[model samples]
Target: MRTHWLSSCLVLLITTLAVAQKNTQGISGQVLWKAGNFMPTIGTKASVPKAVPVVREVYIYALTNDKQVDAGEDAGFYQKVNSKLVRKVKTDKKGRFSVTLPVGYYSVFTKEEKGLYANLFDDAMNINPVQVQKRRWTKMDVVVDYQAVY
Candidate 1:
């Protein structure tokens, strides 16, 4: 009877640990935006654009290849994303957000008035690629600067 009880307790402990580990693994980050005129005048002191936190919806999709996204005519805009969307989360007023996902690679984007926006790409052309590891939280920041002139 004692042996049976011990085995049951061990099983319960292992199950608890597995659940805890799964819950702790995912991604967290903030979204920032840069907008307005950035061009500097020759006689005036150069005023660079400062990035500010923006509250918006963040979309997570499967690791997307270059062919999965359609480029817009305007800079930094995407007309469409053909990849499968995994999840989406809204940022707080301060632009901070966190999400739980299984361990794997994902592509992230922000909803834009024109469509979707993402400014990053890997060497292999993966759009805004991020990796979530087991028992770890991957930190990533999405910068929305499509309306800003550089």
Candidate 2:
């Protein structure tokens, strides 16, 4: 009798936990610069450089508010905004990025510079709406249209 009751309780707990799980999924995309936009190398003797989108490492941030993360506040560039640090991720060497987040709405953007995660640099561009869905990957690609902070 005791064994039967324990098994029933265990089953109930498992079901409840499963039902309580949040609808979270993976989000992935790439940051790219148009190949044609970059012209021949200045220092290189080669006139025709390989035409391809430049793959680089950049900073990415997920925000829950309409306010920009590092909006012109030089200090905000490298400082981690603990108040709104929902998800911060960096793109791979190929400029491919992936992050798992709960299903909901978020404003996403990328910083021009790669390092400076803990130091102030400059504001980011390409701010846009991002949505995560349940049980699937959401693809959102962004292009670096502005110059990186030196």
Q: Which residue pairs collide, candidate 2?
A: 78-119
* Candidate 1 lDDT score at position 76: 58
Query: Model 1: which ten-residue window has the lowest total lDDT?
Result: 17-26
- Residue-level error in angstroms, candidate 2, position 150: 23
TM-score of each: 0.77, 0.48
Give the C-alpha lDDT of model 2.
Answer: 0.54
Tell me the whole-model lDDT of each prediction, alpha carbons only. 0.89, 0.54
Report the CA-based lDDT of candidate 1 relative to the real structure: 0.89
How do the residues 15-108 of candidate 2 rate in per-residue lDDT, one tens digit apiece? 8855644344757888765333344367767544232344544443454332434344543233332234466677777778877877775555
Which regions of candidate 1 deviate over 4 angstroms? 1-23, 37-45
Residue-wise lDDT of candidate 1 within 1-82, one digit each (tens)? 9999999999999999778856688889999998988777788786787889999999999999878889898765688889
